[model samples]
Target chain A: MKLSRALGASVFAAILMTGGCDTVWHPSIPPVAGPAEFPTGQIARGAELAAIGDCSVCHTTEGSRPYASGRGVQTPFGVVYATNITPDPETGIGTWPESAFRRAMREGVDRDGRNLYPVFPYPHFTRATDRDIAALYAFLMTRPAVHADTPPNRLPFPLNQRFVLTGWDHLYLRPGAWQPDPAHDADWNRGAYLVEAVGHCGGCHTPRNVLGAETDGQALAGGEAENWYAPPLQAASPARQGWSVDSLTAYLRTGFDAGHGAAAGPMTAVTAELATVPAADVRAMAVYLTSMMPKPAPAPVVAHAGEDPVFAGACGGCHGPDAPMMRNGAPSLAMSTAVNAPTPRGTIQAILQGLPWREGQAAPYMPPFASVLTDAQIAELAAYLRSAYSDKPAWRDLPAEVARVRGAS
Target chain B: MIRLTVNGQQHEVDAEADTPLLYVLRDDLGLNGAKFGCGLGQCGACTVLVDGQPVFSCLTPVSVLAERQVRTIEGLGGNAVQRAFEDVQAAQCGYCIAGMVMRATALLEHNPHPHEDEIRAYMSGNLCRCGTHMRILEAVRQAAGQGVKP
Candidate 1:
């Protein structure tokens, strides 16, 4: 969904020139005129809040300036191209008054009264405190504006009907006001507020009813996020053997946790975003999540060696007995989500794609097996590694799985 | 010793404490319908019925199953969900079918008659990597005599 430069410019120009210029529409929250004034501290706080919201991850295109937008976010329904949020008067949100931004964030309604899709995660953002929202506004308004455009959303049929979202909003969307819970401690309440309102962990982890509203009875029983599965968050989950408050907070702060492996795919961005926030906030979130668990159980006892002949022959060199604790950041199978995943896709993916160089890191690299190993060999290695390191059952139809993944990639 | 009545027959399995039910069922009793996808309980491939409730066998320790009646896809045999699955050929790779079948059976048994939305919501936990989802939904619909979704 990467748009052509010329097309982006025009669409952006059109958005800036039309619709929202009407001040009579939103009379209640009068739009501020001239240069906006905000305290320096508010800007700094706003920067942190932006990271917590993970705004840049979804908005910015690869190799593009921050907040320039035009990145296409893929969803189950269709691709949602992010609009430019920079302060460019012609193509960005520079013309959007603070009132407009607040309305969009809190009410899921744009400046022109256009209903933004739930894909924007307004349901979560709505929970942010007014001061925090102000800080975000200050931070974004100060950014360098880029003249860019985004492609139009291409959802089929009723999904494309933006008005259909009015009903969805009626069912799921609720404008939020910060309400202090008098019972819990500040830390616990903060964690609860972030997880429920700000962080909106349930947006992905909570399974949804047919109408896409999260099933109330099952809060965090797991659901699909983008294409990746956001595993369950409650007690008796896989984390029973792996995740602790310290480890969970560490995983959230850094991309890696020794017992639970490194963050992969979409979660990497989330981890990176969390790393930018205050350490205490991350710990608070962890505390709240771990509290959901029944009790702490010792980590699973998985044997590391003498599991598979194929693994011993091919992978034992670097991931072997003598392998360094952190070799090019490749995680151990005993703690790797790849091997422990229910579907062979993650394991199959790692074997086929190897490890790519991260954005800023100069780390160890592994060669791809697309040409190096046969489908049968890859299958055998995957099965062996998963069985050896994990107490879980082995995935069936390994050869076919390898072939399918191989062909697709 | 853990006594489990799986697929109607009773078996006494000897294993260390906290060993997953999957290990005992497959390695000991030789009931292999539940495939191991993610041993972490992230995937529903290792699902079986523990007292008519679908549970992940890979994450469930045998110690938790002392008094529970365990039912696997093999136990269901020719039940409506299985027959409907067979009729529609709902499986692609046939790896996740057992788990899906077991979960579907549990849903039908729980509801007896479920709307399409109800079935979808209940079965959302189960995933098919082969993308046999639509056909699986159709199969469940057929199994419930709900007729194939137009």
Candidate 2:
């Protein structure tokens, strides 16, 4: 998800006047010899936590050494390249003491005290327990260090200034380890901690204000990520079937639940990483998330099979009622959360991008149509799908939206 | 009964709605052009033209084919694209050849003179497991050069 935060000049000036300069610089820690060894159990636990955090998804560039960190995340201000987090002495966090690592996670600052852009998602990381952070540090320090300099961020003059982020932290950063609610069971608390802290589902799923802070009380109420909409997990969820713990657990682990459609776009990577972690942890996350969701209200069946030749010719081979995929338990289009989503972007994106073929793995596959079909054809197909499968009103100005998504992709 | 228009002929075939077009073609009508390599549509062995668009007939139910023009390798008979395939000897096991020919025919019909990259991109949906991609690509290129007469 791109960070789209832009501060008004008045707010910037006020923050500067009200002590933006106070903690602008942090004392750099002296480089030290890497730790010789860490407990295997601690490192293993850290590995699991890192998978839940999805650190590699944003940090590592495609086809590069993991955690060397040259992936440039697009933001409204500019592109922010993820910093090298490997234990490389000069280029990475090799010299970072556990305290330094803890501070960075809790305060979103480097050992040298430069304010990190929130694109690193340290806001959510701030709530991680000390034990988890220590484990993560041990795990990271044990990895093969790679020397790679992080590219300079491409932000404009005022935004490029690192101290500006100090003000942002002041406005939004909530620092503390998660505390279990007395009322909830252990599963609920464990799920809550993981979801609210390291899992950080809100990083992409929660809507942000102009300042880029997650909106006050709309946690997980749908947000945008990497051009595709992250569907809400809250009451606003458009899922035709309510996501239960089992369904959510299955979806999180394997990227697909029979009742819901397959995960696509950024979520595909997240689910793949989640597959590596313990199944119980994923199940805990499901428990917490499903608690926030309402039971599936029985939606009145809406059947309008209006003929759209593009859909039939293009989509019918697998998605048609009589198609083998549908007959063999592929989720019906009516049950697809993307098709039932309020916006047409998700459905349009699914059509244009299609599910990529995973090599050797038996996953759902659809050929991309960005080149094959015109924007108008995709837009018409999306409209047909909405009417055919969903009870929601037809999306207005779909052709323009399709053009926008196509161009963005 | 499903009414389907295959090539220039209209035929009423008795089959369930969910029956794949490939099954109806091979089992009932006795047309053996489209082969079933992978019924999941990944291999694209059972490709046919539905209203000028190439689709996997193995995954396409006959129920969705009503009033749509269905063109198989049998329907092509001695078309230029098929002739180009024969001329270039693009078949190894020849199982994937029919589907490859149908996809190439659709591409040639649409573009007629596609560049090599364009041909590769368009034919990506169809797979040839016999390691005969170079020959299949050559066949499409050769057909484009000869200007496929649809």
Candidate 3:
């Protein structure tokens, strides 16, 4: 969810806007952190699991030898360097036994039994089954080992104390494999396992409580990731048009759906990686997700007296009647997902920076209007789209909202 | 197995209960007029008349249509709206026309001669990415003027 929002080079805007937060998770190279322990017996599945776990992303700093930890992860409290997970006898986890690696992953402790920082995402890793962890271990250990020293961390006083994560973990971590519901079909169960546990998609999607535990009852309801608002995944989301299994599957697999447009932000990276996961697995995720979508409410139509010349002069040149096609044809804004989205953020971001190429695919293009149109003008145009095409209520105080969003990102 | 009545013909077909009626119509029954533009309901491309009202067939599950009458462009027949659409050459690519025809038929069935404003608001849900809005409006007006019930 937030992945789509963090799309484009504009994520730097998120960093500029935040005042020290968990924004480290966004706009990073490498994929989500890759796994450490592997099921060496199932090396093939282990490699797949590592990609899904994003083990390589967090653990390996960009341009650095793979898994040679030294990549600085910026957290609200301080910076944490990822640990080396390669097979180097001296530097990496080469000498550690599977049991020690398992303890470190499941218990958030290191070889010498030191507490590891929560930034390692151990809370989510605890859900990985023993076998899968072993595969990941196998995958990591077999890598052409790189000899690089693990960088020292620079954390604020108490945050520097690694044991602080213990209390934090006690409050937030629930270590166990996600058990399945007997009632759901096999595909649904598969999807639940992948989404809630293996993929740990909810780690970034679900909102965290003060103790940093994902809040209950708000699952997939959206969160602020790396400064982007991952829109709610629940069926009741403001995405009034709704998501079908096919659309969701396509979006998850390819990152582009005519209704939703291209994936923006870090989601581009995810969908790129997701392309490698089994197609059946992605389809199952869609099946489970479409079941969760809510029916849309009856939205009244907005009657207008005359055509807003603003649209005619600008959007109309391409999107208006007789307008030439632009950007695989400017998606007819009338039925467009961005326009109909419950929150104005997607629409706002699209206008700020036109959709960019994703996964080697070039979509229709519209030059960014950030420098061209004033914030007030954008708000009016957006409001006009809601009233003109869709039956949803007009966005409130759209001018200030646009300025606030634009200024922040 | 699900039973459905399409174009006044009753038939039983094998499908998952939640499979979209559009798929049932196109893939099973071989009704090909409706196109799948956006499987989501936002776009009315896969629209068909369900009990005299235009419903997005892509989003309407076969289970929900078990007892309802379904009408695709193939079932809509050659009505005044279809005639006007042909007379004015309203369609360019024709991918979206099947849904457009279905929706216009429903609009005229509910109101034989709706005002231009009503036509614009009602048909807004039907997207014509080919820039055929003016011709579409003209066709609707021509249909309304003919005083033919859809």
Candidate 4:
């Protein structure tokens, strides 16, 4: 009877220990269906869908095997190395189930139930539909295995702790796929999906607060990145790079507006990867960007100088009473685009750098006297020009302004 | 060892043959015009003329250039195209100018007067983040003359 009682006690102890164990061993991830069964056509479609996500930019390291993932992405909080997404069983997503992949892409949760930081662009990607997401998964699984291992991130104390991300997501994230609006056209809807889901343009161009949360109120407006301004994408963009649909589309495909501006900084990477994408998608992006332009405001007119002493003495030589003498092809302050720009930054820049003359044109030229001019003098000249020919305000700070233009040059 | 002819001069160098021609040009030959905007072959800042074709020097391995003639921005002709660039003031910050000129030179050599669409298609790889593209297009068009239509 004592032996029987001891046996019962042992059985009960084993059951209790097993039930309360913290280290539950999960089964190995099951293999996804082979690519052959999915049809090669789907894979090609997947490739186009993957391009929308720009998967290669962050996932692959320069000069390394593609998709191996050792690229370091630096955020304000810390640096995170992208993980190997290739199918290597030892060091990559080789064993990730399709469901887990869908959950991670749509909900920003890893297979281990860890909340992924928004730096991975899951905020925008959350809008991706399951069909497209599944296609992407199928595409990724078929890629060859790359046996590279990126080092773990080195985020600061509380932020470094992955558990804290759970609360962060709860406060900031809204988990769901994109919902098309009944009011918008098919083209606009497609554009929105491409922009908000696949393109993830806001991940960089949009302004963010100290916590790296995007300020939605200022959507597509200008922001700063790595000390350079990501000029607003809205219709009111001061740079005037996307004035037309053609210009916008051409800029997206070629990485330059051909007449207005070109891509720089992080945008350089975007354009490079974008070059490989289909022309149709690029055109769609251009249509989307162009449609976002607000109504054009009438060009602000500069007030008459009315015999201002500085212009009378120093400027009259070229900008005379009538028919402003074109020096160095110096654009007539009366009708020049540089004089009429919304912001005086470019205008001030032109003055400081001195306008370069057209080589074969008969226009007069002005040498850049930036070296000789004091900060106040440059500011005064800028103020004088803006007040006389344009309605723009003088730059708030002159030295700082000159310094910025000088730095860019 | 790789045998490459740069700007008509032949040199033999011993190194990892897979090293990008951009590095070989910048580090080995001290040709600094090919800026390193992105190490991947995406950005055309490292574009160079390889056998009269514009190739991304960053993606083209040094070994791939064995006995190949390479032309950089420094070697591009000082013709109407260069004069047009000066006329339109097409460069800002000038970081991408070398690459831009090289690409344009290649375009002009193949099609002396390319239309707007052709210009856009051929020069899409080069990136100018400064937004000076309008001036660039105008300069190219002006160089090729205004009569050419896309």
Strongest candidate by lDDT: 2
Could you tell me how far off, in angstroms, the CA of residue B48 lies in candidate 2 after the best superposition? Answer: 13
Query: Model 4: per-residue lDDT, tens digit, B45-147?
Result: 8778887777667655566566568988766547666778889999888788788877787787778878788898677667799989888888888878632
Best by DockQ: 2
For all candidates in order, the CA lDDT equals 0.73, 0.83, 0.70, 0.66
Show where candidate 2 strays beyond 4 Å. A1-11, A297-300, B1-41, B44-126, B131-150
Residue A362 of model 4 has an lDDT of 33
lDDT of 1 at A167: 53
Question: Can you give the DockQ of every candidate in the order shown?
Answer: 0.01, 0.09, 0.01, 0.02
| All candidates in order of TM-score, best leading | 2, 1, 3, 4
2 against 3, candidate with superior DockQ: 2
Q: How far is A75's C-alpha from truth in model 3 (Å)? A: 4.7
Going through the candidates in order, state the TM-score of chain A alone for each one: 0.82, 0.95, 0.74, 0.68
CAPRI tier of model 4 = incorrect
Poorest stretch of ten by lDDT in candidate 2 chain B: B59-68
- Could you tell me the TM-score of candidate 3? 0.57
Q: Please, what are the lDDT tens digits per residue for candidate 4 over residues A1-409? A: 3443443344345435444323222223354443323566666767777777778888987556878898878776667888888877678777678777776777677666666777888878788887787788778877888899888886766566555555445445677778887787776677778887878887766788646767857767766554444656765565422256666666666555433544544555566566667877777776667677754344344458665443443345455545233433333464443454544565555555444332333322343434323456567767777677755565577667767766655
Candidate 1: global Cα-lDDT? 0.73
Cα lDDT of model 3 by residue, A1-409, tens digit: 2332222123234334542335232221221233354444587777777767767667876568877878787654456889888888778877767776777778777666677776777777787789877877777777878888888898655456554455555556687776888999999988777777667676666777643457877888776444445666776555545677787788887776756555665466567667777788888887776778775334334354356644554455456545555454334566465566666776777766554433235433343445335677678778887788667777777887798778766
Angstrom error at residue A378, model 1: 4.2
Provide backbone clash counts, one per model.
5, 0, 29, 22
Clash count, candidate 3: 29
